[model samples]
Target chain A: MQNETADFEITLRPNTGWMQLDLKEIWSYRDLLFLLVWRDFVAKYKQTVLGPLWFIVQPLMMSVVFTVIFGNVAKLSTDGLPKMLFYLCGQLGWTYFAQNFNSNSATLVNNAGLFSKVYFPRLVVPLSSLISNLFTFCIQAATFLAFFAYYKYFLHTEGLRMDWRAVFLPLLVLQSAALSLGLGLLMSALTAKYRDLVHLSPLLIQLWMYATPVIIPLSEFPEKWRWVVALNPMTSIVESFRLMLLGAGTVEPLYLGLSVIFTLVVLVIGVLLFGKVEKTFVDTV
Target chain B: MSRPAIEVRNISKSYDLGSIGATSLKDELERLWKKVRGREVSARKGQFKALDDISFDVQPGQIVGIIGRNGAGKSTLLKILSHITEPTSGEIVLRGRVSSLLEVGMGFHPDLTGRENIFLNGAILGMKKAEIREKLDEIIAFAEVEKFIDTPVKRYSSGMYVRLAFAVAAHMEPEILILDEVLAVGDARFQEKCLKKIRAVAGGGRTVLMVSHNMSAVRSLCDHACVLHQGRLIQTGDPEECTETYLGIYHPTTESGVVDFKKPENETAWMKRARLYCDGQLGTQLEMGKPLSVEIDFESETEMEPGIGIVINGPEGAKILHASTRNAPSPSFRQPVKGGTIRCDFGEIPFTAGRYTLSFWFGGLSYDTHAEDPCFSFEVIERDLWGCARPYQAAHSILWWPAKFELQG
Candidate 1:
C-alpha cells in the first residue's frame, strides 16, 4: 500500500515528510499537561506513610551519604565550602535531573493504555513528567536553603556564601530540565522498540552521575582530565549551580555556552525521533 | 449534501506480526540487517492485514453505526479515526475536535478519590478545566456516587466504578465523538440511560461514530449504518437495512436440517457439522407441542466430557431458552468418547410460533472453547392450537404451555 496524500485541517498519514514540533498543538493541550502532572504528584504520595514529605527526606539522606563518603572518606574538596551545605546544594539539581530521567524514559510504556485510547499531543507525557519532578525539586531546594542559612549565619561559615550569580539559579534548573528531558525522550522512543533499553536505564543514570561533577568539585580533577569530563553537558550545569548558589566554583562561559548548545541539539533530535516513534508505537509496543 | 464531518480515504492498516515474536535483540538486529539489504523481510512471516482499502464519509450531525462480526476491522477503523494508530496507507480528515471513548475509565487511578478522578478523566478526554468544573455537579448526580465522591474509588463497588467512569465519558463535549462498546457497561437501566444520553448528544448537531453489537440500539439510534466483513466494507446505508444485511450474513441456511461446518466460522468449535430435525424429518420449520432433536457433530481429542449447550434468542436478542447438558439431563459421554455426533431430543418443543436464533457453545477448562451466535435460525409454526378459546401470539409470550380449562359446574 502507498502512503496517503490528502489536504484537510487534520490529515493523518503514514509518515510526514519532515519533523514538526507543533508547539502550538502542545500549547493548546496545556490543561491536559497540568492535569497529568497533578495526577502524578498527587498519586505518588497518596498511600505513603510520609506522603510528600518523602520528597524532602530522600534528598536529605542522599546528601548526608555524599558528605560522609566523598567528604570524609575520599577527602574530596568542596572548594573550601561547608561539607553539609555544599552537598545539599549539589543534591538539589542532581536529584531532579536523575528523577526526571528515570520517569520520563518510561513515559511511553507506562502510558500505553492512555495513549492507545486517546488523541492528544504525545509529547505531553514526558513534558508532564519533567514538570512533576520539578515539584519535588522545589521542596528539596527549600530544604537546601534552610541548611545554607543555618550554617552561614548560626555557624558563621566564612567560605560559604551566595554571589550575584545566585540569581541564575532558575536558568540552571531550566538547563537541567532540558538536558534530562532531551535524553529521556530519546531513550523513551528507543525503549518502545527495544525492551533491553528499559533494563539498562537505571545503571546508565548511575554511571552518568559519577561522570558528572555531582559529588566532586570540577576543580578536583586534573586540569587536562577536567576538560574531558566537562564534555558531559551536565558538568557545566552542576558547576555553575554551585558557583552561583554557594560561591565556590568557577562559572566558565565557554563551557556553559557549549552545554546550552548541546542541550538544544539533543532537544531537537529527541523531539523528531519521539514524534516519529509515537505514530506507530502502539502497534509494536 | 452537507459537508462530511469525517472523510477516510483509502485507509488500510497492515501489521508486521513478525516483530511481536522477535523479543530478543539478535532477532531484531537480523530483521534490521535484512531491511538494510532490501530483502523480502521474511516473506510475509506472520503478516496480517487488519483493514484493507476502507473508505467512508460521515456527514455532520449524523449518528453512524458500525457493525461487524468479531475481528472484522470495526475496532481497527475506530482506532485509526481516533489517531491512536496510524494507517499503513491512508489519510483521515476529521474537521473537528474528536474524542474517542475506545475505553471508559481509561486513566482512573484507584488511589484517587472519585471527585479527583472525575477531573482527571475529564482532562484526559480533552475537556478544559472550566468545562469539567461546570459539568462536575451534573456528572456526579448522573453517576449517583455523590456520597462516596470524597472516598477513594478503590473502596467503591464495581457497579459504582462503572457508573462514574461512564458518566464522565457521557458528559464529554466534542465536535465528533467515537464510542466502542461503551454501552455494554453498567446495569440494564443505566445502559438505557446511556443510550438516551448518546441520542441527546447526537441531537445537538454533533457527529457520532459508534461501534456496537447491540442491534436494537443501533437500529433505534443511528441515522446511517455500515457493515464490515473480513477487513472490507460490505455495505453502508440506512441503519435498519444495513443491520438486516449484517444479520443475514451470519444467519446461514441449512440443507435437509444439516449445516456443513466446513467454513472457518464453523471450525472455531472444532465441529464438523450439525443437524436439527423434528419427529425424524429434516425441516427448517418446527411446530409447537412436537418433539425436536438437536445433533452436534464434533471432533474431540481427549475423553470429551466438555459441556455442550444451545441458546435460543428472539429477534431482539433476548434469550428465550438456554438448554445445556449441565442444566438439564446431566448427560455425560462415556470414557474415551471420540469424534461423533451427540443428539439431545426434547419430548415437546415448548416455543411459540416465530423466528428464533440458535447459538451453540462448548466450555473448556478455564474459558469457553467455542461459541457461535445466530449460527442457525428456524421458524416455529403453531401446528395445533390445542383447541383453545384464545390463542397467544409469539410476540405476546415466548413460551407455549399445555394449559387445560374446565368448568367447575
Candidate 2:
C-alpha cells in the first residue's frame, strides 16, 4: 500500500490562477463531451411534429420572410445575386453563430443542477453546444445548397457562379464557432454571477444581427458607414461567405485579418474568464 | 510507509453571507462607486465559513465515514474533496482517480431513454465509453429495468429511475469513491444491495469516503470514521468511538442523569423533571445487566386515572424496552389522583453497550394528555454478565442474554 502512493494523480488547491486552461482534462472528458452533444441533438426533436426537418424549415422560412420583407417590401439591395440566394447564405451563416451563442450563453445557468453535482470540464458544455449547433447548421446548409444548385445549374441564373474561394466555407464556419463560443463563455461567466445578462442576451443578439449583413448585402450600406459593419467581427465572415459562394459581397483583406485577430482575442479572454469562473461558479450560481 | 490515498491539509471554504454577487448592474455599479470613493463596501462584511481548517487522511482500501449533524460542514467538505467547489484556503492531494456520487441521476435527461441515460450518466461519472459498453448489460440487469430500457426515463416510475441511476453509478470503478448519503434512496432491499456494492468496492483495495447521518450504517460499514462538529474534525479513529462522539455532539447532555423540561406556560398536564438511576444512584452510564429505575415528577390539573409510560430506545432509535404503569400486574397509584411523582423499577437491563434515549408520557383512559418522546439520553456500558472474565463484543448484537450450557455426556 505504501508503494501504491508513488504517484499523486490530482492536487486540489485554493486558487489555480486565471490562465490554467487544463485542455488535457477537457480532452480526457471527450466522451462526456460527445454524449452531451448527442443529447442536445437527439433531445431537441423528440416530440416535434417534423423532427430534424425543422432545422431546414427554420432557415428556409427565415430566408423567405427576409426575401419578401427586405427584397420586395423594404427593397434592400442583393448586389447582383438573387434575393433568395442572397438571404439564404446570410441566414445560414448568421444562424450558426446566433444559435451557438444563444445555447452557450445559458450553459452554466441551465445546467447548474448537473454542474453542482459532478466533476467534469465545464468547458465541455459550450464545446458540445458548438458541435450540436454545427449539426443544425449543416442541415440548413444542405438546404441552401439545394437552392444554390437550382438557381445556378437548373435555372442558369445570371452572375450565380461559385468561385474557387468557396473552399473557405469551413474556415468561415470555424471562425463563427470560435466567435460564438468566446462570446458565450464570457456571457456565461458573467450571467452566473450577475443574472441580469440572462435577460439582456437575447436583445444583444438581436441588435447584433441588424449590424451584420444578414438580410441586406454589405454592398448596399453607405461607404462611410461600412467600417461600422466591419468592426462587428462577424461581418467579414458573412461577407466572405457571400463573396466565395455568390461572388457579389466584398472581402476586404484588412478587415478579415482584423476579424480573425479580434475573434482570437475574445476567445482567449473568454476562455480565461470561463476557467476562473468554473471553479467557483457552483457556489455563486 | 505508503502514502495515504487522500491527504486533506487544513481545507477551508468561505462564502458571502448575503448575495454571492450583485444580481443587477445597478447594484454592482453602486458597489464599484463606493469602492472608488474609498467608502466601506458591505459586500465583504458578511463572510461565512462553511468549513474551517479541517484535515484528515484516508488510506487505500479503507472505508471512512464522515458523520455530522446538519450544518456541520459534512457536505461542504465533501464538495471540496470532489472538486465541485474550490476551497478558500489549504489544499488536498489525491493519489488516484476520484469520482464522487454527490447525487444519483444527476446528469440524466428526462427526455432521453433509459438506455441513453445509462451511457450519458456513465460518462458523467467518469467512465469511458468503452467501459460503459462493457458494463451495459450488467447495469441493465442490476437495475431490473430491461423491459423499459428503451423507454424515456420520464415514463419510468421513480423507483425504476433511481434503480437505473444507482446501477450506472455502481459500475463506475474509480480508485477513490466519494458518496454523499445516496444510499438513503430506494427501498430497504435495494439499500442493502447498494451497501453491499459499496463494501465490495472498498474490498477491491479502493478507498471510500462517505458522509452519512445513519450512525448504524457508519458503524457497520466503515472501518474508520471521522466526526465533524461545526466545521472541525472533533474525532477520528475507530468507527464505534467516532459514532459515539457524533451522537454525543448531536445530543449534548448537561450533567448526567437528570433532565428538566421547561415548565409549560398553561397546560393541563406537564412533566417538570425526569431522572434515571442505577443501583439507587443517579447516573447516565448504566453497566450491562444492572438494575435501573426511572423517576418522573409532574403536576396535573385534573384528578383522574392517569397512566404513565416510559420508552427506552437504543442508539439506532429501535425501541429496547417499553414499560407502562397501566400494564403493571399490580398497579401502584391505582386510585385516580393529580400527578405528583411516579417511579418504575426493573430487574437487570439486558441492553448492550450503546447510547439509549428515554421518553415519558402521561395519559388517561379517555385521552392521552402529554408525551415527551426522547426526553433525555443515557449510555449502557459493557459488563461481564456471563462471568467469563472476557470483554463482550457488543457490535454484533443489541442485547445480552444469559444462558447456561452443560456437558451432559
RMSD of 1: 5.2
TM-score of the first chain of model 1: 0.94
Model 2, total clashes = 1
Candidate 1 stretches with Cα past 4 Å from truth are A1-9, B21-24, B30-46, B261-273, B287-291, B296-342, B347-375, B380-409
Structure candidate 1, residue pairs in collision: none
CAPRI grade of model 2: acceptable
Using all chains and alpha carbons, the TM-scores for the candidates as numbered come to: 0.88, 0.84
lDDT for every model?
Answer: 0.83, 0.87
DockQ versus reference, model 2 = 0.48
- Leading candidate by lDDT: 2
Candidate 1 per-residue lDDT, tens place, B293-383, comes to 8898877555555567888887555787788866665545434455677787866777888667788886433335667767787777766
Give DockQ per model, in order. 0.48, 0.48
Give lDDT tens digits, candidate 1, residues A196-234.
888889999999989988888899899888788888898
